[model samples]
Target: MAIESVVVRQRVEDLDAAVPFYEKLTGSTASRFAFAGVDLAGVGPFLLFAGSDEAVQRVAGVAATLVAADLDAAVEAATAAGAEVVMPVQPTPNGRRAVLRHPHGGVFEYVGPS
Candidate 1:
């Protein structure tokens, strides 16, 4: 399967403060989305969010959320490759996604547009 793109997700304590800094740093306006008590902004390949770190820890740190053309197939492939599902495949406010942990304990998210 071809990997489309990887997005790095970071959790911050404050959305209001984080957005402007990233907006200036990336030189682009952020596309906003809210889900599960978190506010998210996409700045290029970086997905910055304001939420609890503990909640974000379910997926691990600085790991890329891999975008797939076929999310279900991606999950199946990941599972077959020895990646444990951290978050099961499900439809979110934004899309269909799941988090998988590599054998080495690194975590990554696989997502597709709903």
Candidate 2:
């Protein structure tokens, strides 16, 4: 998989509550989207997320979201490199996503159209 941009995900207590701070921090207004019932806003290179404890926990510690040219290939490459799949490939607003924990214990999300 050809890696592209990486987006960082930040957990927040409240979506609306967090927007202005991030807007000022990034110098860019956020574009909102929902994922698995979680309210998310794309603010610059960061994905600010807010939701239930369970939902937040589900994605917690995913240090970065890696964009790729091909989602399947990315998953394959990750698995082949001994990364454990935290979640199988799934649909998202931008494309498909899969979370993985590398053998060394680093966590990340991979995304791409296909």
Candidate 3:
């Protein structure tokens, strides 16, 4: 499976305030989006998010989001390598995603075509 890009996840209290800083830091305009009632902004390789406590908690354990070339193949490979699925494949604003916890215990979210 080809790993496209790794997005560093940041949980912020206010997206409006955070977007500018991230955009400035990354030198890329923020791509605004939302999912599950949470506001999200993609600035370069960073993803900034802010929302209700429930939404925040839902993704709190995920250390990073990895863009995959094939979600199914990535999921299969991860599980085969001993990664446990924390969340099953689901549709996201951008594509489909699944959360997995690695054998060493870091949770990661993988995104790919729906």
Candidate 4:
């Protein structure tokens, strides 16, 4: 599957406060959204998220989120490449996603249309 975009993850204590800095840096308006009880802001290639300890911890440790043309294909390619499934495919705000841990230990989340 083709990778459409990549978003860097930033876990912040306050999403509202963090959004302004990224907006200025990227010269783009932040698109606000919420998922699994976490508040998120997308500014350019950065994704800033903030929420309660429990909520934030649920999404912690994911280094980046990638938009894939096909989530199932992405997962299959990842597994064939020696990646382990950390989180199975599941529904997300915009689509579905799955988390995979590479053989080298980097964790990545892939998202695509539902």
Query: TM-scores, in order shown?
Result: 0.83, 0.86, 0.93, 0.90
Q: On residues 1-114, what C-alpha lDDT tens digit does candidate 2 reach at each position? A: 778899988999988999999899989999998877788998998899999988877777788999898889988988998999999998888779899998999999998884
Task: Judge candidate 1 against the unseen true structure and give its global Cα lDDT, from 0 to 1.
Answer: 0.81
lDDT of each: 0.81, 0.88, 0.90, 0.91
By TM-score rank, best first, the candidates go 3, 4, 2, 1
Error of 4 at 81 (Å): 1.3
Better of 2 and 4 by lDDT: 4
lDDT (10s digit) by residue, model 3, range 26-113: 8999999988778889899998888999877777678999899899999999999999998999998888999999999999999999
Q: Which parts of model 2 are misplaced by more than 4 Å?
A: none
Clashes per candidate, residues 3 or more apart or on different chains: 0, 0, 0, 0
Q: Tell me the spans in candidate 1 whose CA falls farther than 4 Å from its real position.
A: 52-62
Residue range with the least summed lDDT across 10 consecutive positions in model 1: 53-62
Pairs in clash, predicted candidate 4 = none
lDDT of 4: 0.91
Ranking by lDDT: 4, 3, 2, 1
Runs with alpha carbons beyond 4 Å of true place in candidate 3: none
lDDT of 1 by residue, 1-114 (tens): 556999888777787788889889889898998776667888877788876766655544637889999898888888898989988899987789988888888888888987
Q: Candidate 4: misplaced stretches above 4 Å?
A: none
lDDT of 4 by residue, 2-91 (tens): 789999999998787889999999999999999988898889999899999899887778989989988999999989989999999999
RMSD of each: 2.1, 1.7, 1.1, 1.3
